[model samples]
Target: MHQLTDCQLIQSPDDQAAYTSAINENPANAGTTGRTRRKRSLFNYSKLWANGRTLKIAFLDNPPAAHKQKIIAAASQWLPYINLKFVFVDDEGDIRIATGNNDNSSMLGTDALLIHPDHPTMNLGVPPDHADFDVIVIHEFGHALGAMHEHQHPQANIPWDKPKVYAFYQNREMNPLSKTQVDRNLFATFDTLSAVHTAYDRKSVMHHPVPNSLTLGDWEVPINRRISKKDKRLMRLLYPK
Candidate 1:
């Protein structure tokens, strides 16, 4: 049985502003109507950063030096796959991080631009000592880089036993999630145009740890600790380094 808390994908509160900001940052995000014949991986292109650009990451709450370094190091695992550069800073960054809370979340890609300059675009609530700390940080950074939850991939036909799934998240002692949150975050299927449709990868770090108890069959995905081969392929396609 896997017991790991999943990170939620955060969107800018304003939809109109988010769309405008995304296109402005990278016009390719405004995808074309024509079909893309080649199979790629999961990601909303509209949420991707400008290719080959440097993204400044600010630590908003001034976490301990050791804690901050560990977080930066975990996030940097994605650096080799994408065309972007990460520059950690003290203030005023393209992606602002806050460690004052226990809720892990991040604004997808360029949507971070919609947030107030003083606010955080991402939150890393997990402490450095946690067993899954590195994996958690890497998963959240995947969102910060515009990757969606792998379980919600269009090709991932998970046979969820809805009632059990709902109860599991709702009754959890810490950070209980509402039914609406469960539906959107877990059961929602993204658009084909927004993703590169292919066989679902159970090993992607962006996937949630689904216990078999919540599914109709024995289907379950264990916590993926590292970026998978397909994840590398997807990032390469999106950023093209």
Candidate 2:
């Protein structure tokens, strides 16, 4: 995580305009587009109980103890709806510290997060403001439970102003224009409205806030705070009867 100053946080209207422009200017994603033919729901407890296997999760000792607690609490909210037990361990067993390298990818046998102790945001002194530890934990755990990125929803027709988003990320140094910055299969199709969705929610614990510069163009962001209807529906479906 990068430490962003208050000034950096304050994205100006002009900046927003420029970001939208960049998004629109960027070339359309070339790979397969549209919804995935095989739709997978978020969490359906009943079905999971019948067919799903219990998954063991252990967090590497990178994040602070407080941060770990927050992650657990957030997970508890959804655990009752799903049919798996989440276990946390102090030692590096199934999951290990995130080295930020591609080689150590399978630290967690199923799904897990590796926090780099040296990362500016993960380390002390950095404000724990933008990235909600609990939400991030739950979102990552969702992946461990076989959920994919909601933004990659196949049916999603994001009205991204490519140039604008690119410019916004560039200014913030969060740009994913190049293959290194963005995954090649990012635009590949998957059904976003499936039961596993955290709702069409921008504020859900599963969602990341769009840069202010790119908020205007066809992006539906939430004003208040709460999970989206879609999130609830998906959770029920994934863990349902």
Candidate 3:
């Protein structure tokens, strides 16, 4: 079975953000499972990008012209709120993108610097039709900007139906991740000394959708397609003008 490689979850400061490397849904890297309580605060997962430098991005595989623009446009949504500039370039970049694959992920913050260009640091594998292209690119760029999954917030405790979650993703025709994989990518919440998170933003783009069946009682967060209002406020706080 393919272990899950990508998808945001909790992680220690020293470790690269979960998706910084390859994003395969294999089970090798996923950790133990259990539920934990999360307390809300201003969420900051990693060191912020150095100020006043354009974050360079390049697609090594040369995606279609329209596709490239779409990716840039989606990522640019984060630019207005944070102290970040997205500049497309011909040489190696801070975030290296690739296309025509199923594992969509990116390195968080300064971790992109550790990525080897030849290994495809980020993958825009799915086409617009099969996925919400705008949301996917924008969300990945959020990680590139040093953000983790809002769902994994220490204060934003989500009671996940672990078995149903494992079955749901595992049954997916493409990129079926095992239970251990789901535990790490979706259920595992890492404790961090640097987490400066705010109230749980249920509609934040960083949140993955939770089905009604997978959540107890009335708790259910739909797949958020746009950046939330809280996301803007938090970004401004993290990368001040």
Best by TM-score: 1
Q: Which rank order by lDDT, best down to worst?
A: 1, 3, 2
> What lDDT does model 1 reach?
0.83
For each candidate in turn, the TM-score is: 0.91, 0.54, 0.78
Model 2 residue 90 CA deviation in Å: 3.0
Better of 2 and 3 by TM-score: 3
Q: Which stretches of candidate 3 lie over 4 Å from their true place?
A: 1-45, 129-131, 191-194
Could you give candidate 2's per-residue lDDT for residues 176-215 as a string of tens digits?
2453233322333344225233444444443444444554
TM-score of 2: 0.54
Residue 216 of model 1, lDDT score: 94
Off by over 4 Å in 2: 2-52, 62-64, 92-131, 174-180, 183-186, 191-204, 215-226
Q: Per-residue lDDT of 178-236 in model 1, one digit per residue for the tens?
A: 99999989999776333664457889988888888999977888888999998888888
* Count of clashing residue pairs in every prediction: 0, 32, 21
**Candidate 3, TM-score vs. the true structure?**
0.78
Evaluate residue 173 in candidate 2 and report its C-alpha lDDT on the 0 to 100 scale. Answer: 40
